[model samples]
Target chain A: MNNKNSGGSEAEDLAKAEMVRLLSIVGRDRSADAFEAIFRFYAPRIRSFMAAKTKDRQAAEELMQETMTAVWNKAGQFDPARGNVSAWIYTIARNVRIDAYRRKRPEFDMNDPAFVADDVAPADQEFQQIQEAQLLRGAMATLPEEQLDVLRRAFFDEASHSTIARDLGVPLGTVKSRIRLAFEKLRSSLEGRL
Target chain B: MNVKHHLSDEFLIEYAAGSLSEGWSLAVASHLALCPECRQRLHAMEGAAGALLDKADESANEDEAWARFKARAADIKVEEVKLEAPKATKQTVVLPEPLRSYVGGDLADLKWRALGRGAYQILIETKDKNTQVRLLRIPAGKPVPEHTHEGRELTLVLAGSFHDGEELFARGDIEEADGDLLHTPKATEGEDCICLAVTEAPLKFSSWIVRLVQPILKI
Candidate 1:
């Protein structure tokens, strides 16, 4: 991560904060103007993301529609304390995509008795919220082209490990190691920031 | 909370991507519940995923897309929508989430059928036809039947620990066994070992008795 394509600057940070603000307005006031800005910015990115995975333009548009609808309806659920707009919107997109093509993902209940909670909040978590996402995005942008390709396939395309390996004409171990390397790079870059 | 053997980043990536099926997702999510280190890793992975989403290439037909979204939004009444805050109050319970719903309650409530040699298992039903998920209880110092996996098998230690080869897997640790590996895992003599094992294919049991009852056992 030494060469973090460190182009992520104050302008980008300000733009991100603006998006978060717009989202809050959408959630709190149901402000049509704010919602319009959000829909304009995120919908295209989500459509492109879904288009790559679904490989069907019409299906992709439909999935994108469903995701935006969730964003409009569940805007209140987006807690800026936990994550930013990109993290929140992508989560909805992934869920919408999975429900359409794959089985529902199992999630652990935070209230379950067998759970360990994050009792202490991350110190200065809110103040650093914008930077935290920036650091991760910068780290990803710096990954080698090959590693980034695999990362996108696994996450955006939702391809199985074996299927990815076959499609790439590489051994299963190769694909696993590529993802491992990409994650390790990301993990270290966000070490103390998270 | 002190887990020795953690799951691979591959699983975490799959979980973050929503690519893993229900059974495998349960195992990974259960581990995250107890391992803060892994949880941090998962959080970072998610943040990185958000980064990718931000830079995704744009889509075409913009005005039409907005028109479509607005048309759909018009159908829902915002006044009727419920905005419920998630329940975040911590509780002192034994079974961690989603797993509890599957187990029907506490970890102590599960009833198991014997697999002889003091090992017992309760098969958990999943809608996924490609994978089989089960809970295994091995008495202290007892060994599970020797077997090889036809596909990948992920065993998450729910309670106690087990010795597989030279590695020791404690609670919150997941053991990933693939078709290439064949080994017997024994419970350490202290407490009965309970684990959730998810397999992509049925186990290739090395014993005739286990083989005879394969269909009845259902993996």
Candidate 2:
């Protein structure tokens, strides 16, 4: 309803468009500079991505590199017609990080054979990640602003109920209930589309 | 192949966080193949994971990280490998008869093997060595050896019942456990006890021989 929100959505759309264009070139021609550009753009950013879950810098670097290699190998699979490239690459990095974490610790076997194969890249797997992200983003646009913000803070910021309550000037119980209700609504809204 | 045993938001978050066990992770993947809802949740979690990964410290990098990675990439001309191996796709993923009856659709058939007393293994289809997914079925009335979780365990009860400490699991109940808890579960009475267990590590059997056999068994 406000200019700022509209501008934010527009910016996201533009980013998505640029990502699609770059991915298209990468997919068709491995030699294209698009790959290099993407590498440069995301490589630094991906380091921090890994660091959030783990404290080790060496491990984060390893996962970041693995994530980039996937981008290079799976560039051809990106379909601009479906969704944005950021979501696709993000999904790839996410899975690579998960795999890297698994390899570092020798615990029990929780490997997904579907994901473990040497050749099956993230691009080759279902494209649902990007689609879901897109759908959730769209669904998020439909929610009441207060509920949407509460869900984002609770899940994304990992804010505690008390912290969110104090910050938002609401009771801790209200914050907790709002987040729970918001998640339930989100689940119901996206349940069928997923 | 139990549609009813869909991965939940909590499980998806843990999976994205890389906190799930190997066996349980495999089961979730199989479930993902059948349920798009879970897959979608995973994708969203992937985004959140990206944000999480983005928060890491920026000052450090592995000394040989780029060189090692480049060497590995140069060694292989990575291309489109289908998501499912032929064997994985070909194997009729045998579900609990009740679950099988509910699916009413084509399923990935899998090879099932017995893993000592009370324990059984089902080879779920996977795409690579890195993406290992399998199904471990512990039949009714049998209790696993008391053990600490190797990594993160995501257990979704497909049918029957199992108990860990004071809690009991029935159909569709999900339990997420990790190294923090050491416990044993026995299937409840009158049910064959079907469950979808996903984990990133093989169970560390208390017996030394079981550990030795683990490498050979390739579980």
Candidate 3:
């Protein structure tokens, strides 16, 4: 049921909560059954996600395995209270794909000596992370068709903005403005909540 | 006050989706380290991207794939303390992570090479052949080489300030200059300006002296 068009339904919430429990079981007891359940669901999704960005099926398979292995190993890191399972798993898949396909995408280490900490309290940050993903998914269904199309491509396609503009056959300015407008709309919709 | 300049929504979306190459990722990650406002926006962008995963078409799957994965399941090395990496870096007190690893230490650790006219640079090695990432230091009150970029140029002001035409970019401000835009960046008086600059393709140096030295220094 890939009902991305719908807002947060009770069934969707239950499924997400169940996956969170399964992920925690894998994290806690290294349960093969739980891990397989996740693998069956997410592996296909990750493969299709990778297929959109790059056509290398073998590589997608390789990275898909890597993503699952990471889930098995890093499941303990997932916190149900902080965020939903999809956001957490997608973040992992994104990193795995980048490291394998595009080389090392260095990130800001919070443990670094000079790293600046967000002024927001940890409790509040966790609350936002939990609420925002659910809220944004609902908001996304409401985005204008053109804006959503470009935003989806921006997420899935590795192509740069200029390349996107060329393919869309629109002015580069139009592409940029559409993206800006899309994010603005999403931001405005979630203003009081986020 | 927040950093005056920020990465556009386009950059954040690409970066958040894990589509940017190594060099551009470096610029964006380093900027996120200094700018919290962008960090919040990045988190939101990531949430939106995660939502898109729901729409991906599910392909045919084989039990053999699960079998193959199960073959390697025993080797799983669960993280001991969640996402925390080893706190082994001793002198990262100056630069942020991932960049700190690239630099091998903090700000005091950099060994700058002179680039004439009181400017200096250290080219950082990155895997992407299409882009060159470097740390550039322009002395206070000195003008840098005016450049006509053959490709995009991403500059993140790490310390001090630089004026490109009318805009003054201070620490934490990032500027993505591309297309037909030409700039002559002059460091403001009072402090030496140090920044992380990522350039795609070789830039055309306008000053004859700097142009002559450009070949040798490979700026």
lDDT of each: 0.80, 0.57, 0.80
Considering only chain B, what TM-score does candidate 3 achieve?
A: 0.87
Give the per-residue lDDT of model 3 (tens digit) for A89-178: 778888887777647777887776556668988888777766666677778878888887887777777667788899999999998998
- What DockQ results do all the predictions give, each relative to the true complex? 0.62, 0.14, 0.55
RMSD (Cα, Å) for all candidates, in order, is 2.9, 10.4, 3.5
lDDT tens digits by residue: candidate 2, A109-165: 123222112333567344644444444555455667687565545433445556668
Candidate 2: C-alpha lDDT: 0.57
Per-candidate clashes come to 3, 61, 0
Cα distance off (Å), candidate 1, residue B157: 1.2
TM-score of chain A of each: 0.88, 0.56, 0.87
**For each candidate, what TM-score against the reference?**
0.91, 0.53, 0.89
> What's the CA error at residue B54 for candidate 3, in Å?
1.5
Across B95-192, the per-residue lDDT of candidate 2 in tens digits comes to: 43222322333234434577777677655543334333445567778886556646666776655778888888765456667667877888887766
What TM-score does model 3 achieve against the real structure? 0.89
